[model samples]
Structure formats: C-alpha cells, structure tokens
Target: MNNQHDPLSSRPLVSSQEYSEVKNEDFEETACEDSITQRSPSTELPAYKLRRSAWYPDMRVMISREVLAVHLVWLLILAATIYVLGRFTPEVKCGVSRLPSDVVFGDIPYQIVNWDEDSGFVNSDPLDGKRWNQSREWADSTDWTPWDDIHPGSWVQVAPSSKLGISGGIPLRDYSKDGSWDTNDEGYALTMHHQIHCLGLMKHVFISAERNEPIPSTSFRHMDHCVEYIRQSIMCYGDLTLEPLQLGSSQKAIESDTWGSKHFCRDWTALKEAVWERSTVGFDRHGFVFDKVIP
Candidate 1:
C-alpha cells in the first residue's frame, strides 16, 4: 500500500522544528509582556525623548538639589548684608548730665542753699534800697514797665532792684550817657526769664537782684544758682554733651551777646542756646524734644 494513503502515516509525527518554533514564539511574547509590566512609569521612555507631560526618573532629586542650592545662596547673601550693616553702622547715645550741689559764682564757688526759698532777702541794704529807687525812677521815666506788672507770679518779685532800667547804675551817666536800656538788655532779660521757666524751679521773677548795675556777690550767687538749675534741667530734659550744640552759621547771633556788656545774662544765654541746639539735633534723631522732666 502507498504510505500517503496509509492511516498510520496520516498522523505523521509532528516536526521537532515546528514545535520548537511555536515554543520559541510563545516564550518571546511572554518575555515582552513581563518587561512592559515590570517597568516604572518614569522609565517607560528615554529621558531626552520623553514628552513634556512625562516626569523624568532622576529629575526629582536634581530639582530638589537645585532649589536647596538657591535657598542656601539667598540665606548666605542675607547673612552677609546683616554683617555689613552691623559692622559699618555708627552707634550714638544721646543723654544729659546731672546737677551739682555747688556751682561757681563770680570768681568763687558757693554752696546752693534754700533752693525753695526766695532769693529776694539774700542781701538787702540801705544802698540797695537807694539803687532800687533809682532803678524804679528810670523805669517810670522810660517806656519800660515794672517787673511785677510784666510778669505776675510768685516766682517774680517787684522791687526797685528788679525794675528794667538802663545799663548804668543809679546816676545813669555812669555807664550809658543816655538813660536807655537797649534791645540787648531786653533780650538778656527775656533769655533769663525763659531759662528760669525751663528750670521749673523757684518762681522768683527777678533773675538778677541788681537790675541796672554789676551783679553783687549775693545776687551773683543767686544767679549762679539759677544757672545751675537750668543746666540740670537741660540735662534732665535732653541729651548731655561736653561739646556745645552747633546750630550752624545761621544761629551765630544766638551764640554771641549783641548786647554790650559781658554779664551773667549773656553767659546764661550762651548756655541756653547750646542746650536748645543740642535738643534740636536730639529731636531729629530720636523724635522727642526732651527725654525727662525739667526738674
């Protein structure tokens, strides 16, 4: 019989080549599917070829590192700026001095006593009375008003000696040939009054006991006391300094006494001007005129 027609030959043995090819194809397809399943989302595409919407596997760590570097650089810059400012900026402490118990009067120093008491009774004599009368007459004859009429307060006393008169003593011809107290004297008096007011001390209005003549020792002592009180007030109210306050050339007139004589009034005015100038600067820096009470 022909082998092709034989039933036994109809189910010929399957070729080993065909079986091997089928098995190989199946194995390759399974390997491909396993590789796709095991891959992370980030690594599915090449880093450079990945779409803008896709995330890079290592980009997260790199971006975090870049951000951290930027923050560190900013922090370093801020620290450097603070250091520069602290190193270069100047420090200024504005303050004042204390009042001493004793102050200089005329050429000699005297102790301050009875600060609350009136200075009117310190030294009164027959000559002082005559001088006082003369001063009153001078004030009445001229346009000047009486001290009591001008300043009405317990701190102020109306006495012949306290009257505003010409620069000369009683006779008037001794100092000023014409019996006239110029604006200089008025300025001095005004300065004295303001200083006393600033001190907030005894209210006696007569800053100078001997109004028309040179200051006497007792009167000078009183004047010195007032000056000390003013100095102390300035210290308490504003910044203190060994150097005088400079208000520039515009305020030069305040520094100098345009009034003829070199008296306690002139000296006191100088002190006042100094304190005012310093207080102005303090105000500009600190935003306050005075730091403490006047007293």
Candidate 2:
C-alpha cells in the first residue's frame, strides 16, 4: 500500500465532524426507511396491512375493507339463491337430480281390459249370494246398516269404477251404528262398489219380477239411480271400442255383446301407485290430504 500522501494516512479528506454528521444522517435515514417498511410497503396508502390473511385471498398484503365487504355480500347472495331454489319449487324426482317445478306433474300409465260380460259376476243367479257378494266387502249391510257407510259424502249417490280396486279401492265403513251421518269402517271399496251395489239391488228386483213379487219402493229408487249412474259412467269412461251390432241364430239383427270387449284403458297400476303416494287417505283407508301432500 502507498502509505505516504494517502487519504487514510493524512488528515481525513473530509472533516471528522462533517463525516460524523453525514454518517449519523445516513444511519437515521436507513432506520426511518426500515421502520416505514415494517409498518407498510406504501407511504400514500393507509397503514391497514394485517398480520392474518383472508381465507380466500392468501396474499402477504391485507385485503381492502371495501373488497372484503363486497366478498361478504356475494357470499350472502349465494346463500339466498340456494334457499329460494329449495323453498318455492316443487321437488320432482328426475334420475339423480330432483327437479323442482309445479308445471311438471306425475305420470299416470294405462293398460287394456278385455271385458267379460259372460263372467259369473253378472250371469249368475241374483239370489244365490253371487250377485250381492260383490258389495259385501264393506261390513255386511244386509238389513244391518241404518244408512250407507262404505262411502263418504253428503249425497248417497253418483259414482262407480273398475280395474281400479276391489271396491274402487275406497276405505270401507260400518254404517250399522250410524243414523244420518256416514261412518267409516274396515274393508276397502271404491266408487265401482257403489255401482255393484246398485246392480245387486237390480238383481233383487229381477228376482222379484221372476217370482211375481212386488218390488220395494226403495228398490225402485235404487234401480233408477243405478241406471242413471251407469249411463253417466259410460259417458265418463268413454269406452270407444267399436262394437258393431250382431246377428242372432235366426239371422236377425241382435244386440252387440260386451263379452271379451278389449278396451284400451288407463294403467291402473301406475295410476294406483301415484294415487296412493298423492292420496291424503289411500288404499290403507287412513287419513285425508294435508297441505296438498300425503302425510
């Protein structure tokens, strides 16, 4: 090293007091900068940097208060959307996903029924307990019940059915103890049962005619109601199967036969399943509908 005339060897190139002042100023500036950096990276911005990070934004810097507020609002909106979808919409099952909708109703299927008019149900003797046994599904009303108990209504008339249920699948009742009000009991019979009951009445009337006995006034009333009911049911069922008039053994024009009449029909099974699921009180003969849903 050149020791002579060197700045280090000679009196300082700059005065000691000046150097100390500069050094002190440099040290103070560096310390101030370090403190500012610890508090925040930006000077113009507020000292709002947080130690903890937002769950969504894992950046080293804190999220703005306005931004955090917006995120909370968005989350609330999402929750509300989910709630609305679940509340107002009707839940209909569609594969893995259930669709909620009032416009989409359930399905009712169909089947073919080959009517057997020659069957024992009608062809047998009315007095042989054959014609009337059909109505016996409900508690025996053979001069027992005071009024009609198998059915439910203010009116004792207007209904019947078939391929539907044993007794139109209606819940039966014991009318034996009832006076004016309808009483429900064991056994199930639908509207068709009522029609069958009417037929049974007609059968008794037929036996009376055969024996030359006077028909009861009630029997006449029942016969009239039954005739009207059957006529209306035919209109309602709308069995459009074409039945051409037939010719008798004498080659004369004879009435068409109902035997083996193939009818394109609503599938009782599918409709039955849907009915039970939706029915307030069903084949089990219990309860009525509540809140428009089967409980």
Cα lDDT listed for each candidate = 0.34, 0.44
Q: Using Cα atoms with residue i matched to residue i, what is each candidate's TM-score against the true structure?
A: 0.20, 0.37
Stretches > 4 Å off in candidate 1? 1-55, 90-295
Worst 10 residues of 1 by lDDT: 280-289
Candidate 1, residues 14-132, lDDT tens digits: the string is 32222222133423443344443433233134334334324453578799999999999999999998766443343222321111100111112223222232334333232222112
Distance from true location, Cα of 240 in model 2, Å? 0.6
Q: Which stretches of candidate 2 lie over 4 Å from their true place?
A: 1-109, 125-189, 266-295
Candidate 1, position 56, lDDT: 50
lDDT of 2 by residue, 29-129 (tens): 44344442323233232233222212335342355776888999999999998777554454545422233211222444457887765444444444333
TM-score between model 1 and native: 0.20
